[model samples]
Target chain A: MKPHPLAGALLIAGTVPIKDFPLLLGKAEREGDFLLVDGQRIPCTQGTAAMVTAAVAALDYLNLDPPMALLAGDVGEGRGSRAIYDFLSRELREFSPKVLSLHYLLPIITPMKKVISAVQGCNPRPVLIADAGSMYAAKAAGLATEFDVFTPDAGEMAFLADSEATHPAYIKRYLFEADSKEVPRLIGQAYGCGNAAQTLLVKGVVDYIARNGEILETVREPDVPQMEAIGGTGDTITGLVSAFLQAGLEPHEAAIIAAKANRMAGKYANPTPATRITEIIARFPEAFKDHLCEWSGVCTVESRLRPATGGARQGGEA
Target chain B: MGLFKDKSSSRGRGLTLFKEVKEALKAEKILKVSGYEVKLAAPPPSLRKGCDLAIEVDLMGQAGVERVLRQNGVEFDRIVSIDTEELEPLRVVKVTDFGDSMMVRAGNMKVAFEKATGIILNVSGGGCPDVPYLHLELLNKKITEAPRPCELGFTLCALMLDRALDEGVRIYEEARG
Candidate 1:
């Protein structure tokens, strides 16, 4: 396998079948609801495809190298998942990405363990982010703390809070009933049980960024209520955070910014309950442009020319 | 039912409502087998009319209890939290017919099969890791002969797929009859 020396991030996700085996690696582009990569077209309507496509859009907006994607054709069957695990174990040694995001895959413990081991052994260990099935598998296998960040929705958060529950379906009924309002308690339970990563980006009506069991930040502004019901919006937030991490932002910071940017994207999309996730993803560039300067602490030309006032630092120094 | 009439006694407890007493009893059994502290009780008269029962569980274990019931295919109508407001059970399954083929979707998980042969045409959706395994297990096989998704997988997606499979099998059988 050729090395991806310049690859800042790697997205490992699965797509609905198109007859590809092992893995397909390349820069990705969204054409309609399909993610075109390495001479293959993967549907982006949901799951890993939606997440990777949203990440690619954010990376493109930031002018970073498009994420190196490792995709397998999986429609729930373990073939693509097994292929991904095998590829990661055998080929991850050749690539050294700064950010590694794991998305949809079947939660198979043994092979997943090998892949995690391989990832841990990488030189200059990459920042690990897991969402969807990857997060579920990591938490289920008791390896969630090894990752840098976990992006979970309220439903998934309930799973994390119930240390004994291996999957969301089995989370304690009380925790699930608590819903979004009980996220802080769930975060505490997750961290208390050591089932959470170093940081958690909990997506919901109000996005919470927690690190080390402390709620560091919560972003509720630019609230697009309709975004909650839209499939793949949570996936887009994971994608945005992964790109921000690739851009050298701290996990917590990346999570906060991603949450805000996602909402802004939703606002830009002017989404209704009927809006498609792709429509929201399409506004990522504009969303990033609107907030990147402030979020990254970069001075715009106009801000750079502003005079210092009221003991503020000169030259637009935040 | 009179035992639950004292509202204060129900504090910090949630009720899993069911359309029938049998479903409540089944849910209680499933939750107990899964190690949850739950009881089948008559709901307060104000909560429901008729002879239906409710499975009361510690509010703290609601998510886990519900999950176990769902995984076991023991359906309930809804879960009422301590607030007395109805928390509608997620009814995510939908079926679409394409003449020879029929597709059933439960949440993000989808399963489609040939109506006449009961052969699964495709298995798709879901972000769970076991999906690939379940997909491989169900695809290109007769739906009736394949292992049920919940038996082979552990995630909610698998349970949802199992629901789809159940619906698919029912549709296929009814068509043949």
Candidate 2:
């Protein structure tokens, strides 16, 4: 697929512990195990840092501009989450992004509603993707349908399938028992209950991409069993798919390619149970170089050599 | 006395309701151990049902608290901000008794054990990759002696398995006593 003119901000929003309330915005860079953004170092071992680092790496590999990150230091406290919500409510119009990926924020309904309202007010509405805490909040607030994509693991799928489940832990016993084999059923149940996004990238042993309760595609290749044990592999897939969506790939296509690339990246990393998510992410550039052409029907790998324009903080040092 | 004083002074307080008082107690222990500032509190009159107990938590860290609770397999009905509208907690576990054995289920995980010996007969359910590994670790062990599922595995399945195991042990102890 030929890349479109990179338009608007490719934005990632989440929380990490570095301070209390101030929202930090800048191009994200991975330095060692930490994600450095605007002089603030966020650990990449888990949560939003891992997701944003993988996304920044993928965009960088594609020679696209790195993502602009909106981060706060929220160590499970509400202050940083409130800060992020306040910023989005007050500044999202001015900081309109083309694609906004939400991760690891406290799942409070009022703030999430405010943030959604701010996002909806953007001149050109952003493609909204949610995972982890954001996804849970969206579902809890009955706003999952507002998102373009939700990247959920099997456990999360169970939560979505049970219309009454406000959180994964509280899903009905029968639904939880359904497991991965019940993903297709759960997808249908989620859509039936109006608790599903426009597109569901259900990540599991076999990644399933579904739209409107209909299965679009499945990618189970390049099997990397060790990837399951590694924390943040799901987050990395969410990051890659977010970048692909921002880069103008269709939602289903982005989901498919990202699933394959994540597995391939794992293969390239030759990961073990002890492997960190960053190691798999470090292989994204090589994995993309080897497969982007074939996957997207992009004419040549040479095209990737040319730097893309219009990315957030283009040409700025991290 | 000062330190033990109900630290429920945070402006943004939330309550986690469970189906049983035992569930609430278990969740409180898990949350405290996980570094959350939480306390067991009586559910408001409007919220009381099967369980009179509820866990009070700082609303600000609700997401983190919920994640930890879920990770450790502490099943709760719903976490509601104290200021929000009352929502009822759902009872998700079911205990079924057979002549020789009993099964306790929480979410997708089930623990069945011989009644006389409390030896685990089967551990099943959950779709996470860790389920099979956890199943192996818990099978054939006495409910009280089996390792906690959350300690041995890292998945929602493991958490649910832990929930089942916890319930199973409680039932066995109650029967014996």
Candidate 3:
């Protein structure tokens, strides 16, 4: 098989907008203190912190060499981001990636009033990027456009796809509602053909890549069940796509491979009972490029890891 | 005051297993008891269901604890037992297998810090990051700085429980639901 060109030097990143209301269970109650998970009992505050830690923990699962590359979204105080960053520095000395780059747009944090640099202070990774609303955060930190490439989804595309912009003449923010046939034409002529090396990879039923404002390529995710509705699906997709890039696949190839793998993973989940998003995430790796793809009539169960330390892992650091 | 001493089995309404009552004892040590199994029940106006009572033995299995209860003419259905192998919050919460995931309800509990903004959260868990991650996804969105409490995870949860309560935030039933 021909190795996908345009591999490595790849950075993957995405953002998670935690739900505003805590998914608390019951009425609020006072004991001595603490607004609990149930409002009546457990203490489970700090939602964004949970996700950031999750990302940090996810890094532990990486099959890295050294200076393991880390890529995750950022907010001011870098509160959660800072923890992951620090964790990488302190604990994980064994298998670090040669470089680290974030694949996410920065977001503003309140109270700070100043735009927080979500991806600041990361070592060895030469680029710090901003997209959409995070653009303001990046610029505030004086690191806007430091990146070799900037990637965004459709919603972000509209924000940057203005005709006034130099590269992609038009970014299709409304791609969802836009007629399908017209999409290729608009993306190709207006978005993909632009002079900007900066790319926007919009995730949808069909993943589209627009670079320098030109439509680079499109790969439809084959047989991806309705997994998008369950939150964090996009984050996982972005992670995989970036992983392919970091693993030496071209941006476009990364998109295709990630889309296929995500679909296959979801397809794997469709039949199983108690299919937790967590379970699918854990079943990754061996399910992806690892185990041989066995096409049993029932479902393709990927080859699992040779029995080792313990057993198949429940994946991710987060 | 003299709960857990009654060993005499009184067969009556709301009969719960020894395991169930043991869990209730673990939950609210000073629970009011009634009927068979001595299940924990809150006073009226706080009718949270599933409040059964068992021997109110101190957390550590005292040497004469079981004997005292047996000696004292305490009426109960059966002696509840808990393996304690998987007791999550051993210091605060213990589960006696009640034939199912032990269900606990907080009674006479007041809404501690509901509409209060600007609180701090601290998360702790086993070396595994499942609960901490879930806690973060669920809690950290609302508060500030619920960082990893410690290097040793078990202690982190203990600290988290204590800190949240000290700050006037009422802790409630863990949101396993």
Find the candidate with the highest TM-score and give its number.
Answer: 2
Ranking by DockQ: 1, 2, 3
Per-residue error for B98 in candidate 1, Å, reads: 29
Candidate 2 local Cα displacement, residue A216, angstroms: 0.8
Model 1 lDDT at residue A171: 49
DockQ of 3: 0.01
Which 10 consecutive residues of model 1 chain B have the lowest summed lDDT? B1-10
lDDT of 2 by residue, B82-146 (tens): 64332322236666665677777675456678889998766543333244345556666888999
Highest lDDT: give the candidate number. 2
The regions of model 3 sitting more than 4 angstroms off are A1-99, A103-151, A162-176, A179-197, A271-276, A289-318, B1-177
Better of 2 and 3 by lDDT: 2
lDDT of 1 by residue, B54-135 (tens): 8886542343455577778887766665432323323445566665677776544567777778988666555665565566
Against the native complex, each candidate's DockQ, computed on alpha carbons, is 0.10, 0.08, 0.01
Off by over 4 Å in 2: A1-7, A18-22, A300-309, A312-318, B1-177
lDDT, candidate 2, at A145: 96
Local accuracy of candidate 3 as per-residue lDDT tens digits, A133-214:
2332232223333433333433233323333221111122243234334444544443332412254455555667665555
Model 3 misses residue A89 by how many Å?
15
The local lDDT score (0 to 100) that residue A173 gets in candidate 2 is 59
